[model samples]
Target chain A: MTRLPGTAKTPGGLYAAPSLVWLSVFFLAPLAIIVAYSFLTPGALGGVEWSPTLDAYRAIANPTFGKVTVNTIIVAMGATAITMLIAIPCGYYMARSEHQNILLMLVMIPFWTNFLIRIYAWIAILGNEGFLNDLLLSLGLVDQSVRFLYNRGAVMLVLVYTYLPYAILPLYSTIDKFDFSLLEAARDLGASKMSAINRVLLPNIRGGVLTAFLFTFIPIFGAYAVPLLVGGTESYMLGNLIADELTKSRDWPLASAISMVITLVTTLGVLLLLRANGTSVLGGDDHEAAEPAGEADALGAAR
Target chain B: MEARKLIDISMNLPHCALRIEDGSDSVAGPVSATGNGLPRGRALQGGIMECGGAKKKTVKGSDVVIEHVRKSFGEFKALDDVSIDIRKGEFFSLLGPSGCGKTTLLRIIAGFEAPEGGSVLLDGQSVLPLPPDARRVNTVFQNYALFPHLSVFENVAFSLRLKRAPEAIVKARVSDYLALVELQAHASKKPSQLSGGQKQRVAIARALINEPSVLLLDEPLSALDAKLRQHMLIELDSIHDKIGITFIYVTHDQQEALSVSDRIAVMNSGAVLQIGTPQEIYEAPATDFVARFIGETNLYEADVTAVSGERVDLLTAEFGAIVVTATNPPPAGSRISWTIRPEKIRIGHTEPRAARDGINVVSGVVAEPIYSGFQSKFYVDTASGAQLKVIKQHADWSDEGPELAWKDDVWLSFSAEDAYIVEVRR
Candidate 1:
């Protein structure tokens, strides 16, 4: 298994040699280094040292680190759930109508403006003296000034707004390709409107949902921007802790250890997801993952 | 500016005035341009009226009616003032080339599109305002939008689940339709796991499970290969026979339409140019468009010199003159087209025995011989500077192999009855 795939079998050594060399030099070597670093203790200077220790992983079970992990999961799951809820209906509507280009553009136009700028715009909108508050006060809907920023709710809102386009695009691609005839087929079979959506539409776009979740969830799990800018003491996430370890405290060993632990956890989570769905995470590049019917249907449904 | 161009083009669409099939499964005749007067005495030439056989025969009422339905996409008119009546339980076809609004018309019937100007009726009730589910008609879309996420069994059972039917009944019906499409073994397989033909059958099973009043197919076999299409056609015919539901099948493939539809509605630029049985449409046409579109034909522009009971004498600039006999299409005038089927064109070394029967024959030189296995097509240059198409059956050619060489002068003769004046109102 360690030998280059076709190197031993091939009568012609010419084709096999270059590929084997490239794989060893580029892929296998870097991966080995990463694995070794994950298990090793950091040097007093900066880089990996020779001492083999499980202390890096042991510290991951600490209450503070555990809380960060929990926070990451919640934010990731929250962002994913919110994006799915908003994207599915919007994507479906856009796909069904003849005027899809305009709708698609509406979803994308916000993207042309810088991501940081969009986040800044949100700050203005959510500020106590912001446009929303002003409008509400002018309309006599609110009695006094109200703060909507510097909280988990604010982070969730920004996550939804920032990652919404990503979620919708995958969903739209899957949905746009949907053979509406299947829905009609369902209807002809005595399926009602709600039934058609539930049976046909929902199942078809399951991939888009999972894909949208992964695309948004993974990034938001490590997201620091909206949370940092909007949040204060309580809203500090795993990203802040990693940055604090590496920068504020000048604790390279602890930082590298934290980095290694986070990487492992993420890799494991992804692998578990891929596995539970009967998809092979390993062999993805060499051979395609055999996605189960549900995920395939979901992905295709959204497209 | 582009939007304005689109709106202008859309607003000026012509109407689709096609025949109406009714609840009783019979041609209720077309909604006459004159008004609500049914064919009083002599409308259709034959007793080609009885639509469906046996069982429920309700008062003849149009199942579907479209009046001045028009739609546009960015300056492209998809459906122009299209009006058509699809009879209940009849296999009706909408035939046209690509981008000719045939699918648009089908979508309009299915309530997928709201016609800008016009109303659609299903079972004598107006359905323009109704949603697709409320319209009670199922559509078999061209691209079999089978749920890729679902196993064939689950895809078929989805609608049943939606309707909240008994689990056992859903299982039974799904199994039955799966057996019908010969995909019982593959039912556990998802649409992605199935081949294109298998997916198509699953689509059919899914649509048929609802048993809609009208089953609309938008080029259902367009994706399949020629061989698979042939098999699908047989399966479609059997399914239609067994279910006896109105099949509003749409396709640009003339052969498919001619083979399946009881009556075909030939549409052009949104307007229905002609509607008739496959045989009648191929034989006697109501317009030049119809003559050219339905089958292999030869058309020659001629000046009308005289007219009598169901016959017109025309002077051909190049061939001197010829008398044409035809069924009454409209009031004849000068500058009419003379159309004849390729098979109707006769070529012989010896004089035709029935040449005395006022045969309209013209001298022509064979310019090209195109072999088509069972038949050879001869493209000939007539004295009139027009190319006349002639078909020689392979059996008739013998060892000669339609031996007419290039530029070989030969007399092309046909009985006056074979030549018809094709819809010349000029």
Candidate 2:
């Protein structure tokens, strides 16, 4: 019962070569370029004239970059945290329910109306005298209209509402395999509703939580539009900062440095979690390590 | 002779006064019993049987009583008017095919689903009013339902932690059950690390670790391979004896139910057909449904021509007038079903015994012998075209082997006692 190892050529290896070549060229080369760019020094002439140096990473320790990095992390982490808090239960409810057709339509409804347009729709929603403020004022809930636009709250709200689907989809996939009968076993074991939720439900979904977190978190660090339209100048994430560094300041070198840092940190996050569980928050496309053991195949197929 | 009997001096009367009273007719009208207040009970007008000293089994208590239980989802009836008694510490089974309401019955008993009509009782107390966690029964679900995120030890320790037992006792008890399941080495590893048999054992251990009065198992061994299932039968029997708790095991696997259950309630179309032991269920199923469901059986519709002593002749349209011993005779002129187990129909070389032996035997060509390694079954066809199955014993006929091949003329005989007669509507 010896299975043949793949050959160097033939229809059996039809898919492998193109995939390997494409991955090597597109994926590996870009990461290699980013790594090469990270260790290179920028010329005084204001373009990326490469001189091998660790000065770019050293420049990242500057106070301006540090503050922006911290701010970027704060915004990303906040949005990721908030989105997951909403999406995990949403995903769990969707997974453990029989209303899949309707729920899927609902989950896809946000997708049907365009992603960028969906964010713009939120601008209409959070406008000072828009639907929300007007409804609230007429209902006598607030004496005066509040500043709903150009704020951290607006950014957080749009972040959650916009990337909320991203957080939910990964979690939905994981929760689909969450062994719901295990929850029943817990309840049958005399675990109260809260105890079952905390002891049974939460731990099984931790992988989904981390996945959804990374799905929403890393993307939030690099978001350009949502915070721009929603939060304005105060909530300048690294994506906006990179855009400004490249466009407004005409500083391609610094912009590349920021992009390199973004790529590096995302890789670290992916690597750390993938090292722990062998699957990424975003489906790991680049790992050349041994595949996750055959057990996951049986489990995934069973699910 | 061991020690002379000594009466203690503390037997002196300590009571001061003797009081006697009579109960007045201050009793209110019938209390709201089953939520809707359906008038129930036959009380002695105004009699109150106080529980002081002498215990009454009839009036006082019962275990795992499901009465007038009906449950539905939308328009589909999952359980309808299902009522049964599960005695204390008995290994009872709710056995049926898929969608026949066996698991639903188990769930209703576990308080997972509330029945529409009647109530569920555990130890004379209604559990229908309680949530699943409040009930004194725990369920081991199909696929074991062991926590994949937790180790075997944590899975068993889970209920103890939920009950907030002391750390030392929880550890000791969890270890004891881990040993009981024979997975002490795999205690620290998660469920993903364990095999299917080990997982099911852990699930059973987890359910029983709470020491609930009743344990509900919903096809817990259906996930295992055939060999594992056979192995689990012995393991489950031993565990049942050791735990001494009422196990209400629900499964569609008939052999599993027959092998493990002390009593089985065969359900079909949301109703119990019969409740009996495995042997009783197989050898003498009360209904056609139960008989056919419990094992391989042959059924034929016929009219009883004569009811003689321990034998009757049935005139079947397809098989002509066939005679079989009647353990219980129907009316002389009545349409009845003749059910005979496949193995009970003896296929022999000689002519089957006639009048004195109580019945006529069908003579047919051996249409085919389906060989499945262990046993060769005979599909005999009478000239009248009724195909009857008979399991030819491999052990006896092996030495005289290969004689009963295809197209060999054979006589299938059986005692009238082996055949059962039931009223046939069509």
Candidate 3:
């Protein structure tokens, strides 16, 4: 076999071999176990039986599973849309402002605290006897404390709040790499301010926007913690159902099948997103989708 | 001599009419006489012509009149009471080092920046109130900021498309412009696919397709390598020649400004030091800044002692009692400074027997000699510890020549006509 210059047989492969081994051991092996569990029949006790059957996959067609799937899609899509709407402008400002480091630091401040603690803190602020209701009641703006927690609105608010930083970081990276001079050039060529942003600024940073959308959407789709704490019965999603099947009902086969279905759906969604953006998950050659020549040189040379 | 004098008089007479501060009837008379038409003359006199009419005139370009423009950003005065007049169809350069407001002035004319206290008149109409999109001007930005997502054809067609021109007309015009820049074959390719020079050509084509009265170029060639920059400079001049539109080019490169500009305004510290033709700016620079900024020169502080019709004798600390040619000499007992370009000075192995009336010579020892292919530069240290630089062109290819090595005594001679008197600003 011909040895490449930077692989083990060449230098590069030798360097990359450790990470490949790690992924196979920690991720692929567990995933393979899950797939096998989904195909097996349940045991008389809590373990799986040796016989293979399609009963777990058939159970996925139940009406409750259908409701959970639709609810998950709604919450995930809503949170993704709302988070992105706020993140795009926030990212643009963070990237273009003179005080970019300070703004970025502020965006990252919430990440320093634990994720579960931050969601709980939101509950303290939004609950009936919490800070907001107490302030409103004292100010005579409300006759009584309103029920703000344990609702769909509370779940969505917390979901958008939780994933906002994820959206902004990727969006900022992409928009920050954009050459601001393109906007000026567009205006010089007779484009109005609005048209310039629409034509030049938005199109150039579409990759970042797409990346931000997918980064928020995927995690929110399988979200469980925030919904359990703040969401009411109507807000229960697929993640809640999966937990119920695995723990309360002890139906490992059915839970594994649902988990597999969720994974398949999310994987398809990611693939679709990447395809629409003309990018490959593995980052193959896409000439039209590549960064502009000057921008690439500017960034590469800077590094 | 009389015929030459008559030619000089005739040349200056028309310019005299143009130099009228009020810009009244005398200006119109000569402008009309030059076949610019009576309507343009009346418009020029009134300073109230429509921008469209101005563009349609046979003159083919708009005149830019900046009247005492002053701009400040917080504490730093970027443009301090600066004024200039760019004639129609002229390739004018705003030449200065960084932070000298050359770029700021170009931006103000493009309506990207608004001055605090001056009016910018384009083709005799004030454009200060107009926004960038409304103005009939386009800029070729410094980095050739072509849109990355668009094809080369779409980038060139951008302005026409914005105006909602018909599809057929837009296609034909865009293709024509692409052919002009020699990028028709690469029209479908994105900007990321082309080389640096190709990107710059696309930028130029995009700016020109608008057919603005004045095209602003903000150091458009600074990003390229030396070879490509020179090649592009030639192409830019030819494009300007063919289109005959006024070009306001901004650059800090003296060679670029000198090689391409019909008139150049040399700026320093947010102020214009001098404005003139290339020869006038080089041969008769108005200030010490202009003299030092434009080229290499040997400057000397001297006291004027005698003035005798076109020749002034000065007492200098270094070279004693030097005589210089000056049409307007400073009065006796006044301190002055004069500059002699290195290329103008002649180096000799031995001193000549007699000095001519308009010639100044000084004896010095060669401090250093640097020899490139075309010329040799010698730093000669005089008796008073002043180092005067001199350049000698290697006209003959033969290596055989009178060699002046380190510490060799030599004499430098230069004519009074070559030494120019510059103002010593406090």
DockQ score of the complex predicted as candidate 2:
0.24
Query: In candidate 2 chain A, what residue range of length 10 has the lowest lDDT sum?
Result: A294-303
lDDT per model vs. reference: 0.71, 0.73, 0.82
Backbone Cα, N, C clashes tallied per candidate:
19, 1, 6
Between prediction 1 and prediction 2, the one with superior DockQ is 2
Off by over 4 Å in 2: A1-70, A97-102, A105-120, A137-144, A232-303, B1-62, B164-167, B305-329, B352-365, B370-375, B383-385, B394-412, B424-426
Off by over 4 Å in 1: A1-72, A86-145, A159-208, A223-229, A241-261, A278-303, B1-62, B192-196, B306-308, B327-335, B395-409
lDDT (Cα, tens digit) per residue for candidate 2, span A1-303: 112366355666666667777877888887777667656666555456667776666666788887777877888888888898889889988998899668867987887887788887887877887888899999999998878989777888888888898888889988888877777788888888878989888877878877888889888888889877888666778888888766776556567778987987898988887676644222222212122223222112211
Superposition error at B173 for model 2 (Å): 1.9
Arrange candidates, best lDDT first: 3, 2, 1
Q: What's the candidate order when arranged by decreasing DockQ? A: 3, 2, 1
Q: Pick the candidate with the highest lDDT.
A: 3
Each candidate: RMSD to true structure?
Answer: 10.8, 13.3, 8.1
Per-residue accuracy of model 1 over B296-392 as CA lDDT, tens digit each: 8987788887778777788877677787786663354568787889998787544455677468777788889898888889988876678888997
Q: Tens-digit lDDT track for model 3 on A1-303?
A: 233456657667888778778887898888888899999897766568879999999999999999889988999999999999999999999999999999999999999999999988998999899999999999999999999999888999999999999999999999999998898888889999999989889888988988898889989998989899999998998888888888878788888999999999999988887786774322322222111223222112211
Better of 1 and 2 by lDDT: 2
Whole-model lDDT, model 3: 0.82
